[model samples]
Target: MQKQSKKGFTLVEIMIVVVIIGLLAAMAIPAFQKVRAASQKSAITNNLRQLASAADQYFLEYGIETITSAKLADADVGYLKAFKAVATESYPTDIESGTDIEATDVPTAVSADNTLTIDF
Candidate 1:
């Protein structure tokens, strides 16, 4: 009589496949998180730019110098009207932005320098 081999994978083979999959998943997860963080940073920087632009336009249109952050949320003539920059995640200020944005860079860019810089 001839001996017969198993048709399915052995226990060792199955465990090896599982470990490989887990390792692949572990490596892939961090990469995904890094990408997500980068995208978020880009988004926050863009928001800052838009907010600054809106303030510039508002000043140009109305000659207002002390434009408050709250004004940026106005839907009537605000640049960030659609975005609603007031909704901050961590801070109680006009915006949290989830980034280390320089407060000075905003107004200076809008009024003095007229240059938008994404202070990341």
Candidate 2:
């Protein structure tokens, strides 16, 4: 008689591996989400800074105190070549000096009330 050898993992071993994988996933998911949210916030902040810089440049060149986001982001006559949104958010139509710019309807990942504001 010839002895037979098991070539694969047993059922219990497979179940243990699955449970370990599940636990690792459970531990990793929330951290990944937090990092993603932080990254989004940073991107949004950078966009706001770019907008503010363009606005400042426009002010210095044109001697204007107020400008629309659209005007700043314009291609032909605007300081910025183009403005990009990082997430689901809205930019102010009218941006003025000494006033803050706010992005509304931001994703829940970034904020609780779905809004982000930055001072210019």
Candidate 3:
């Protein structure tokens, strides 16, 4: 009589594979989350820089230091309309003004005296 070999994976082998997969996932998830947070921060910083540039242009053209409200007003449009419009479209869910902007972990430096500070 001839001896037959098993064609399927052994229980121990399967369990080991599952454990390894689980360990890999556990190690990767947190790193992925950190990467996501960093990406969001970068986007926010870029948006802020764009906003500051627009504010500067607005000030240069209209002689205003800060945007009137968190919302860009009509007078403020000429300075940052292009950039703001693009950012508004790209980050639709996160788009906000004033306090909401501050809530996104984006550092802000607007002065109490109404002067806008450009800081990233």
Candidate 4:
């Protein structure tokens, strides 16, 4: 009679693999969250910058110091082609040249204070 050997992994081996996978996930999840938050913040900052630039352009073109967000975002004659909010943040309606533009109720994921201010 010929002796036969097991063809599959042992229970211990399977458990070891599961534990390794769990460890990897534990190390990865937080890093992924941090990266996601950073990306969101970056996108929000970019939106703020766009708003500032558009406000500047509007001020230069119309020779005015104050412009409303609605006017700057107007479809037909706005300085910006289109302004889209990246998150649930609210932008300032009244912007004055040489002053900072503030966005409120920013998503907590992007900012701790839930506010973003862009100085132009």
For TM-score, candidate 3 versus 4, the one ahead is: 4
Q: Pick the winner on TM-score between candidates 2 and 3.
A: 2
Please provide, for model 1 over 22-97, each residue's C-alpha lDDT reduced to its tens digit, 9 standing for 90 to 100: 9999999989966765564455456666666666676677775646556667676546654532223211134333
Clashing pairs in 2: none
TM per model? 0.62, 0.91, 0.58, 0.81
**Residue-wise C-alpha lDDT for candidate 4, range 1-120, written one tens digit per residue:** 999986999999999999999999999999998888888778878877988999898888889999887887788875776656776888888989999888898888778899988887
The models' CA-based lDDT, in order, is 0.54, 0.86, 0.49, 0.85
Can you write out model 2's per-residue Cα lDDT over 1-120, one digit (the tens) per residue?
999996999999999999999999999999999998999999888888888888888888989799988888777875876757788877788889878888888899999999889898
Task: State which candidate, 1 or 3, has the greater lDDT.
Answer: 1
Task: State residue 55's C-alpha deviation in candidate 1, in Å.
Answer: 0.4
Q: How accurate is candidate 3 locally (lDDT)?
A: 0.49
Which portions of model 4 miss their true places by more than 4 Å?
1-3
lDDT of 1 at 4: 96
Best by lDDT: 2
lDDT of 3 by residue, 7-93 (tens): 999999999999999999999998996776566555655665666555555556766544542344345454444334212223223
